[model samples]
Target: MTDALNDDRKGWMSLLAKAPPARLAALMPDLPDHALLRAPEVGAVMVRGRTGATGAPFNLGEMTVTRCSVRLAEGAVGHAWVQGRDKAHALRAAVVDALMQTPESAGLHACVLAPLAAEAELARAVRAGKAAATKVDFFTMVRGEDA
Candidate 1:
């Protein structure tokens, strides 16, 4: 892939990274259908920062990130995690893993990550536009009065 497209894909991945497992589950039902020879188990939790517009840094509360690994019936191993209590994320991550081990990475990326990314982008754009429209400019003008 070209650098621009790669960057776009990264953006898509980032959206998927932040996505809640439940949301993803609604979008991709097949994620949870795979028979898990292995199942997801919590591995780690870490505190992360919340960034503001213009990349300003802000400290947000710690988030719990669970990681798990699973093996499908076809002998493909996958790993994934969800923020908070999201089992769906772990399941989907495993499915993606199994797909990646096969020749289905492109399909998974397109069907799952791409649409999620597009939706996220649309939501962000809408929010930005709304905020911009509501912006209020304040100014003070001085006039020559009795002196």
Candidate 2:
């Protein structure tokens, strides 16, 4: 796949992962039946962290996650991994991923991804606002002699 396509898929997958399950479910219309290549299963993955964005990574902890993979009748395959053990969420995400690769992806992007992106952006703005409200800037006033 082209880098741009991969990036686009990554963006949507991240959005799907972070989206609220109920909200995502509400946005989904009737889905076509597909075979589950990998049924939704709960597992723990070791979380890792870095002191800074470029720092050496270390194990942060383990987090419970659920993953699912599905293949559509038209041969599109999708996969999803979501935090927590929501099987339905995983299934839905996987299906969406697969569908997004098809020619009819435009509708999926409109009906699903667009709203999720909006919601995610709104949440980010709210969070940034809250953080900014508490931000403290430190400055040292120069004495007359120093100035």
Candidate 3:
């Protein structure tokens, strides 16, 4: 795949990872024929973080993650790793990932990815609003000590 296509796939995969499984199932009721290359399984992945935005990376901790891999009948392969122990979420995400690589990708992007992305953005906005509401501004004042 070209760099542009790879980038686009990354965006869709992110949306799938963040999306709720039930919501994705609702959007795509019928999945195309596929074989499970890897059954959904829960595991731990080392979570890493930086002290600040660009600071040195450090191991934050271990997080529970579920992963699955699927291959469509037509040969497109997909894989997914989602946080938590929701096996169904991982499976559904893998299916979507495979579909995103097929010729039906455009239609799926419009019908599925677009809505999921919008919902994710809305959720993010709501969280940001709540955080902003609790934000406190700090300031310091200079006193006329030498006058």
lDDT of 3: 0.91
Off by over 4 Å in 1: 1-13, 31-38, 42-44, 48-61, 73-76, 143-147
For each candidate in turn, the TM-score is: 0.64, 0.88, 0.86
Taking all chains together, the TM-score of candidate 1 against the true structure is: 0.64
Scanning candidate 1 in windows of ten residues, the lowest lDDT window is 8-17
Q: In model 2, where do residues sit more than 4 Å from their true spots?
A: 51-54, 137-147
lDDT of 3 by residue, 1-147 (tens): 999989988888788878888898899888789999999999999989998968999999999999999999999999999888999889989999998888999999899999999999899999999999999998857658854
* Best-matching candidate per lDDT: 2
Ranking by TM-score: 2, 3, 1
Which residue pairs show collisions in model 1?
none
User: Can you give the lDDT of residue 38 in candidate 2?
Assistant: 100
Looking at model 2, report the run of 10 residues with the lowest lDDT sum: 24-33
- Specify the poorest-scoring 10-residue window by lDDT in model 3: 138-147
The residue-by-residue lDDT of candidate 2 on 14-130, one tens digit each, is 889888999999999567889999999999999999978679999999999999999999999999999998999999999999999998799989989999999989999999999
- Candidate that scores best on TM-score: 2
Which of 1 and 2 is ahead in TM-score? 2
Report, for all candidates in order, the number of backbone clashes.
0, 0, 0
